[model samples]
Target chain A: MELLEYGFMQRALLASLMVGLVAPAVGVFLVQRRLSLLGDGLGHVALTGVGVGVLTSSAPVGTALVAAVLGAVLIELVRARGRTSGDVALAVLFYGGIAGGVVLLSLAPRGQATNLDAYLFGAITTTTAADVAVFAVISGVVLAVVWLLGRRLYAVSDDEEYARAVGLPVLPLNIVLAALVASTVVLSMRVVGLLLISALMILPSAVAQLVGRSFRSTLYLACGVGVVVSVAGTAGSYYTGTPSGGTIVLLAIALFLVVTAGVALRDATARRRHGRQVEVHAAHPHEHGEGCGHRPVPHGDHVDYDHDGHLHAPHRTGTGTHYDEHDGSAHPPAAVVPPVGRERP
Target chain B: MTDPAIRLAGATIGYGDVAIVRDADLTVRRGEAVAVLGSNGSGKTTLSRGLLGLATVLGGTVEVLGAPVGRLRERGRVGYVPQRHTVSGAMPATVREVVGVGRLPRLGLFGRPGARDRAAVAEAVEAVGLADRLADPVAALSGGQQRRVLVARALAAEPELLVMDEPTAGVDAASQAALADVLARVSAAGTTLLVVTHETGPLAGVLTRAVVVDSGRLTYDGPLAGAGTAGPDCHHPDEAARPPVRGYRLDQPRPAPDAVRLRHGSR
Candidate 1:
C-alpha cells in the first residue's frame, strides 16, 4: 500500500490503466475483424514517429501521434485500392516503418540520438505527468468516439459492401476505425512498445472470448482481463525487479493459455460425457423408449427390421431379397437376410 | 420507355490492356429481372463489375438508371451484393448492424441515422427473415445465413436496381429456395434486379430475361425463353427452353456455313 502511494508508481498505474482500457476495447473489434496484426503494425509506425520526434528535436508524443495517424490513413487507402490482404499490407507497412526509423535515427547528430531503447522495450519508470495527461486525453477521445459510433462501426466492420448497399458511408467509417486503432497503438506504445504491443491488444481479448458468449459480454470481459493483467504485471515488475512490458505481455499470454486450456477441457469433458450418455441410451433403449428411443437405427447398421416380418432397410442396403429385376443392375447384392428362426437348409 | 434502367453500347471490359469482353450492347428495362449466365471465367463478373462501376469500361458508353455510369451515385439508387466470399465473414458485427449499414448513403456526411433509417433497417431484416437473429454476431452464422444478412443489407438501402454477383454461391438448396423466394418478393415490389450466376435452376421460372457474357463480350441478352437459341455456340442448350432470345453474338462472327451447321446440330 505504501508503494502505491509513491508518485511514480501512481503515474505508472494510471498509465497502465489507460492502456488496459483502450487496448482491449479496440482489440475486441480488431480480433473480430481478424486484424490483430494491425496493432503490431501501428506500434512500429509509432516507433518511427518517436524516432522522427527525437531527430527533429520535437515533442515525441505529438510526432508519434501524427506518424501513426498517417500510417493508419495510408493502410486504409492501400486496402481500399489494392488487391493486397490487410495482413500483407500491414506487414509491408510495419517493416517499412522500422527501416525508415532506423535510417532516420542513424542520420541524426550524435547527441541528438536519445537512444530509444527505453521506448522500444518500454519503461514505465520514465512516464511523466505530461505523458499521463496526454494519455488521458487520447483515451477519453477514443472512448468517446467509440461510444458514439459503436453501433455504426459494428455494422460496417461486419460487411463493408453490404453496409454500403444499406447506405452506410463505409469508406469513411473504415477510415475512422483505422484511425482509432492507430491512436490506440500510439498510446499503448509507451507502455508495451512496438514489439510486444499486439500481445496486450490480442491476448486479453482472446481470453475473454473463451469465457464470453456474446459481443457485449466479450467486450466487458476483455476490458476486465486487460485491467487485471496490467495492474498485476505492473506490481509484479516493480516488486520482483522484472521488465514491465515483457512481464505484462507474459502475464496476458499466461491468462490466455489458462483460459484456452479451461475451455478446451470443458468442451472435451462435455463431449466425452455426451458420448457415454449416447452409448448408455443406445444400450438401454427401454429407459427412453417413449422419448428418444424412437430415433432411427444407428447409420452403420445394414438392416432395420420392423416389429413385423418385413425388413425396413435403406435403399443402399443391397439385400438379395429386396432386389427387383427391373432395378438398374449397377450395384451387386451385398447383404443376405435370413428367415426368422430357420436355417438356410 | 425512352431510356432503359441500364444501357451499355460497344462496351469492352478488361483488366489492364487485355480485353476479356468486347463490343457488347445491352439494355435492361425498369422492373426487369435479368440473369447474366455464363461458365466460369466467361466475364460474367467483369460485366457485373463494369455495371456496378467497380471495373473500368474498356471502350463503351455505360449508363445506369438514365445517368452515365461514372456519374451515378451509389446511394439508394443501386444496391449490390458481390460474391459471398468477396467480403470477410468473420467481421465483428451483428445482423442488425450489418443491415443498418445499408442506410449509410442516406445518412450522408456528418448526418446521423434517424428513426426512419432504423425502421428501414428493421424492415429489411424482417424481409430477409433475420429478425430473430438481428442481434446475433455475423461471424457465428452459417454461410446461408450470412448471405441472407448481405441480402437484407442490400434491401435496406431500398434501391431501384439490385445487382447480386453470384448471390446463391456456397449456399444450401433450402437457402437457395429462400433466396429465390426473396428475389420474387423484391421483383414483385418493382425493384429491377440483375443477377450474375452459373446455376440458374432455382431461378428459372421467375427470371424475366437472361444475358450471357463470355470472353468480355455479350453473347446473349433477352427473354429467358430466348436465351437458349440466342447463340449457336452456347454450351448450355437447355437454356433455350426457358427464355426468348433478345440478343445474341459469338466471340468471332461465325462463318455462314459453320453457323448453319451448328444451327442444324442444335435442332
Candidate 2:
C-alpha cells in the first residue's frame, strides 16, 4: 500500500497504464498486417537512441524516439524503393540498431552501458513526470491517428493492392502507420523495456482475437486486457518485489494461454455434441436421407452451418469417399465446397 | 456513343522503368462488360492495373472516365476488386465492416461515414446475397463467400466502372454463378466491367467482349468467342484491333519481369 505513497511509483503506474493501453491498441494493426515483430525492430532502434542520449547527455527518451522514428521512415523508404526485399531490409536494421546501440553504449562512460541495460529490462521505479508527459502525448497522437484513419488502415491492411487500386495512397498510409508504431514503441520502452515492449503490443491483441467476435470488439477487448494487466501487474510487482515490466508481460502471456485453452475446450465440446446429433440421425433412416445426404449430388451448392454459426465442411458417410454424382467436375468434391475460415476475399 | 469507360492508347504498362505490357491499346465503352484473358505471367492484370494507376504507364496515354489515368480524381467512381487473397487473418472483421471500407474514398479527409454510407454498404451486402452473414466475421465464411464479400465491397462504392482481377479463379460453380448474377445486375444498371480471368465459366453469359493477352501483347481483341479460338496459329482476322506480338529481341536484353512481382509483394 505504501508503494502508492511514493510519487515515483505513482508516476510509474500512470506511465505503465498509458503505455499498456496504447501499445496493444496500435499493436492490433501490426498484428493484422503480420508485422507483429516490427515493434521489436523499432524497439532495437530506440535502444540506439538511448545510447545516443547517454553519449550526448540529452534526454534518453527523446533521443530514442528520434532514432526509432528515423529507423521507421528508413525502413518504409527501403521497402518503397524496392532496393531489397522487406524482410532483408528489416533484418539489416534490426541487427544494426542493436549492434550500434551496444557499441555506442560501450564507448560511453562506464555507467552508460548499464543505463542502456535499464532500457532493455526497464527501470519503472525511476519513471519521471517528463516520462508520463511523453506517454500522454504519444497516447493521444496514436489514438487520434487510429480514429481518423481507422477505416483506411483497415482497407489497406485487409488488402493493400485493392486499396491502391481504389485510389487510396497506400505508400503514404504505410509510412504513417510505421511512424505511429515507432512512436508507440518508444513511448512503451521506458515502462516495459525494449526487449519486452512488443509483448505489450502483440499479446493482448492476440488473446483478444481468441474471444472477441469481430475486429472492433477485439480492439476494445485488447485495450481492456492491456489496462487490466498494467494495473494488476503493477500492483503484483509492488507487493511481491518483482520487476514490473517482466511481470506484466508474463501476465499478458498467461491470459493468452487461458483464452486459447478456453476456445479449444469449447470447440471440443461442440464437436462431441455434433457427433451425438449425427448418431441420433443414424438411428432413424428416414431422418438421415432427407437433409443428411451424406454425399449429396454436388450439382448445386449446399451450405451447412455449425452450432457456432460458422460453415462446416460438406457432410460425408462412412465410405469416406465423396463425389459429385452427375457432373463429374474435375475438382475434387470436397474441395468445391467452401470450408469455414478459408475464404480469400 | 458515350466516351469509353476506359481507354489506353499505345500505352506501355510496367513498374518503375521496366515494361510488362508494351504498346497496348484498348477501350471499353460505358455499360460494356469485357473480360481480359491471359495465362500466368501474362499482362492482363498489368493492363487493368495500368488503368487504375497501380501499374506505371511507361509510354503513351491512359484514361479512365475521360481523365488521365495518373490524375483520375474520381476515386469513388471506379471500384476495383483485386485477385482473391486473404484480406486480414489476425484481425477478423465482420462482413459489414469489410464492405464498409468501400465507402472510405467518398468520406474524404477528416470525414466519417454517415447514414448514406451505411445504406450503401447494406445494399451491397444484399446484392451479393450475403445479407444474412453481414454481422459474421469474414474469416468464418467459405472462400467463395469471402470473394463475395470483396465484390460487395466494390459494389458499395457505386462505381461507374468495376475492374476485377480473377474474380472466379478458385471459386466454386455456385459462387461463380452468384457473382455472375450480381455482375449482370451491375451491368444492367450501366456499370462497365473489366474482369481479368483465365476461365470465364459462369461469367461467360455476361461478358460482351474479351481481350486476350499473351506475353505482354494483345493477341486478340474482339468478340468473346474469339478468345477461345486463340491458339498457336493465332490468325485473328481483326488485324486493325489486334496488336502484333512483339516477340523478344535477342539483340536486346530482356527487361527484368520482377517489377510486377516486387510491386505485388510490397502491396
Candidate 3:
C-alpha cells in the first residue's frame, strides 16, 4: 500500500489505465474489421516518431502523436492510390517505418543521445506526470469520438459497401478510424512499448468478443477486461519482480484463452444436450423384422448393392436395398427372419 | 421538355486501349425510366458510368440535363448508386450517416450538416420505408434493407436523375421486388431512372424502354417487346428502311442451354 502512494507508481497506474481504456476501445473496431495488423503498423511508426523527437530535442510523446497522425494520413493515401491488399500495404509501411526510425536514431547528435530501449519495450515504472496527462487527453478525445460516432463506425465496419450506398462517406470514415488507431497506438506505447502495444490493444477486445452478445456489449466488456489485465499485471510486476509491459501482455493473452475456452465449453455442452434430445424423439422402424424378410442374400452380410449400383442390406426395412446386374442373388437363410407375433419385441 | 435529360452521340467507352463499347447514339427524355440490359461484361456498367462522368467518353459527346455531362456537377442533379462491389461491407456507419453523405457535394468544403440536411435524410429514410432502421448499423440489416438504404441515400439528394448499377444483384426475390417497387415510386414522383441490370424480372412492366449493347455496339434500342429472340442487330421504328446488319443473325440458339441450366440451378 505504501508503494502505491509514490508519485511514479501512481503515474504508471494512471497511464496504464488510460492505455487500457483507449487501446481496446479503438481495438474493438479494428478487430471486427480484421485490421488488427494496422494497430501493429501504427505502433512501429510511433517508434519512428520517438526517434525523430530524440534527434531533434523535442518532446517524444508530442512528436510521436504528430508522427502517428501523419503516418495514418500516409497510410490512407497509399491505400486509396493502390489496389494492393491492406495487409500488404501495412507490411510495407511497417518495415519502412522501422528502418526510418533506426536511421534517424543513428543520425542524432552524439551528446543529445536518448535511451531507445525504453521506447522499444516500455518501462512503466519510468512514466512521468507529463506522460499521464498526455495519455488522459488522448484517451478522452478518442473516447469522445468513439461515443459520438459509435453507431456509424459499427455500420461501416460491418459492411462498408452498404454504408457507402446508404450515404456514409466511407473513405473519410475509414481515414478517421485509421487516425484513431494510430493515435491509440502512440499513446499506448508509453505503457506497453511500441513492439508489444498491439497485443494490449487487440487481445482484450478478442477475449471480450467471446462473452459479448452484441457490438456495444463487446466494446464495454473489452474495456473492462483491459482495465483488469492492466491493473493486475502492473501490481503483479511490482511485487513479483517481473517486467511490467511483458507481464501485462501475457496476462491479457491468458485472459483471452480462458474466455475462449469457457465459450467453447458452453457451446459444446449445449450441442450435446441438443443431440440427446434429437436422438430421443427420432423413430426407427427397421429395428423390427416386419418387412424385407424375403430378399435375396447379399454378397457381403453387412452390405448389399441396390438397383442403381448403390449398396444396402436386404434385411434393413427402412433402408431401401438395390441389386447390381453383375451380381447373382443367393437366397437368405430362414433363421434370419423373426417369428410373426413378436413384431414389437 | 426543354431538352433531353441525357444525350450520347458516337460515344466510345473503354478501359485503356481496349474499347468495350463504342459508336453509341442515344437520348433519354426527361422523367423516363430506361433499363440497359445485357449479359455479363456487355459494357452496361461502362455506359452508365460514362453518363455519370465516372468513365471517360473516349469520343463524341455526352450531355446530361442539356449540359455536357462533364460540366454537370455530381451532387443533387445526378445521383449515382454504383455497383454494390464499389462499397465495402466492413465499413462502419449507420443508415443516417450513410444517407447524410449524399449531401456532401451540396454541403461544400468545411460545411457541416444542418437541420435541413437532417430533415432531408429523415425524409429519404422514410421514403424507402426504413425510418425504423435509421439508427441501425448497416451490417445488421438484411441485403434488401441495405439496398433500400442506398436508394434512400440517393433520394436524400433529391436528384432529377437516379442511376443504379446492378442494384438487385445477389439479393433474394423479396428484396429485388421491394427495390423495384421503391424505384417505381421514385420514378412516379418524377425522377428519371437509369437502371443497369441483367435480371429484368420486376422491372419488366415498369421500364419505359430497353436498350441492349453487344461487342462494343448498340444492337437494339427500342420498346422491350421489339427486342428479337437473338441477333447481332435488330432495330425497330421502321421495317423497310432497316440496315442490312439488322437482319444479320448470330447462329446461337434461343434459350441457350447454359442460361436454362443457371436458372434452374438458382432455384
Question: Which candidate comes out best when scored by DockQ?
Answer: 2
True contacts kept of each: 0.23, 0.51, 0.04
Candidate 3 lDDT by residue in tens digits, A143-232 = 988986665666567555434433455677788888899889888886778888889888988887665534666788889989989888
In terms of docking quality, model 1 is incorrect
Query: TM-score for every candidate vs. truth?
Result: 0.77, 0.85, 0.68
Report the C-alpha lDDT of model 2 over A1-345, residue by residue, as the tens digit: 788898988998898888888888888888888889889999998888888888898988899989999999999888777744877888989899999998888888765445666789787888888888878998999999988987888777767767777777788888888999899988888778899989999999998877776789988899999988977887788888888889999999999999888777776664466567556545544422336634433222344323222223344445442222122322212334433233221
By lDDT, the best candidate is 2
User: What is the per-residue lDDT of model 1 for residues A1-345, given as tens digits with 9 covering 90 to 100?
Assistant: 966888998998899998998888888787866778887888888878888887888888889889889998998888877554765877888898887777777777886746567667788877899999999999999988887777667666655544554446667878888889888877887677767888888888888766663566777788889988987888888998887899999999998888778767766664465356445434533321224323333111122323222223333224222311111211112123221111111
TM-score of the first chain alone, every candidate: 0.80, 0.84, 0.80
**Residue A268 miss distance in model 1 (angstroms):** 3.0
Which of the two candidates, 1 or 2, achieves a greater TM-score against the reference? 2
lDDT of 1 at A94: 84
By DockQ, the better pick of 2 and 3 is 2
Q: Each model's DockQ?
A: 0.19, 0.37, 0.06
Better of 2 and 3 by lDDT: 2
